[model samples]
Target: MFNEVRRRRAVQRVRPGDGRALKRFRWWQLPFRALFYLRLTRDDGRRTVCAVDVRHWRNNSSGNVKACLYVDGRQHARSGLPAAFPVPGGVVEVRMSAFGLKRCHYVTADGAEYQLVPDGDSAEGRRAHFDRRHPALSRGVGFLSSIVLVVAVFLLVVQLAEQLTRADGVSPYVGAFSSPVDLSAWGNSVVGLITLTASTERALRLRHSWLLDGAAG
Candidate 1:
């Protein structure tokens, strides 16, 4: 079975207005183009706020596209451009207004447009939505994993060098004893060569395994 996975935050909108009216608007008219919409209304009964909207799409790579905002049918001031939209990504904070009477509109990248209405107690909804959707990671697991792998390889090389040193063969003293220092030097050289070859092989094997795993994944 094919599963449909929604991209988080592909598009977002915010509408602040009167509390009671915003609730009615959400139930009746908020656009379904949003994966979800959040509304916020202030406690003082005077301010309303909407949170960003998350959109679902396939290709979001288009760099920051200029968007024109309209307030109650009149062109509003253009704000700073938003972050680049990514493929399969969502948008946020599409619109905002105060009190139940004000409305806002946004014209997005592909010429798709959205309308927002402000209602009471909507600002809280907006804050909640932002908090829930904000991307946060617990830790840098990939970086830590790479660091551990490097350390392991270094230790393995050291262990292999020790084994190679012990594997070196020395000639036995038969008729006359050779200089002990010379015998020791010869043994050390043999061990060094063995260690070099072993280390090279080990490194190649590690790299090969990494590539194989990556391909499989």
Candidate 2:
């Protein structure tokens, strides 16, 4: 996310001109709990839209609210709006200033980021491609599963080690009591080993040619 306070300062209008500009300036100065909309245009003919709909107050609240529209390494146009722009669907189209080169860059608003690419002949196709490549739900689930697995393995190992140490001082008999305890210990040890092994396998798989080859197939 780009810095919101800096964005507002960068885009703040010295004197209001367009309706969009006025709305954006008013929106940027709003209190934190209020909802706002921001539409940023670039120097080149590229537009990226975003909205700020948050309810948290902070010192320099404007810094918490960011809106950026970039072209190449430079920021062409940007805005910082307070949280109260009532645009339908909370979407605003960024417009570019006249006479500039179209280049690749990114835009960020209210923690939401967007890339501004050349509007090709197949605009719909390009958008679909981007959507397919960035499936938020799938990525989130995978991240969460990795975290859970790591935590579960750590807890399992701690519990298993504690139980095994206590059991080691007990009888050497191979009867029913001994058998269940041994089996329990074996089961826990196997689980712990498997968890550690799986983690190692995953790490290796990340850079493994075999995984890539299988995927290519």
Encode model 2's per-residue lDDT on 20-83: one tens digit a residue: 3212223333222222223455557466443332223332334533333322322333344321
lDDT of 1 by residue, 1-217 (tens): 1111221232232222222221122532322212122233334554333332322121223532223333222232222223112211122233211111112333343545343432332443342344346524212322333444454445445554454555435222223322223325565556444444333322211222332222211
TM-score of structure candidate 2: 0.20
User: What local lDDT score does residue 123 receive in model 1, on the 0 to 100 scale?
Assistant: 42
Stretches off by above 4 angstroms in model 1 are 1-139, 170-217
In model 1, which range of ten residues has the least summed lDDT? 94-103
Best by TM-score: 2
Question: What global local distance difference test value does model 1 have?
Answer: 0.30
**In model 2, where do residues sit more than 4 Å from their true spots?**
1-132, 168-217
| TM-score of every model versus the real structure | 0.19, 0.20
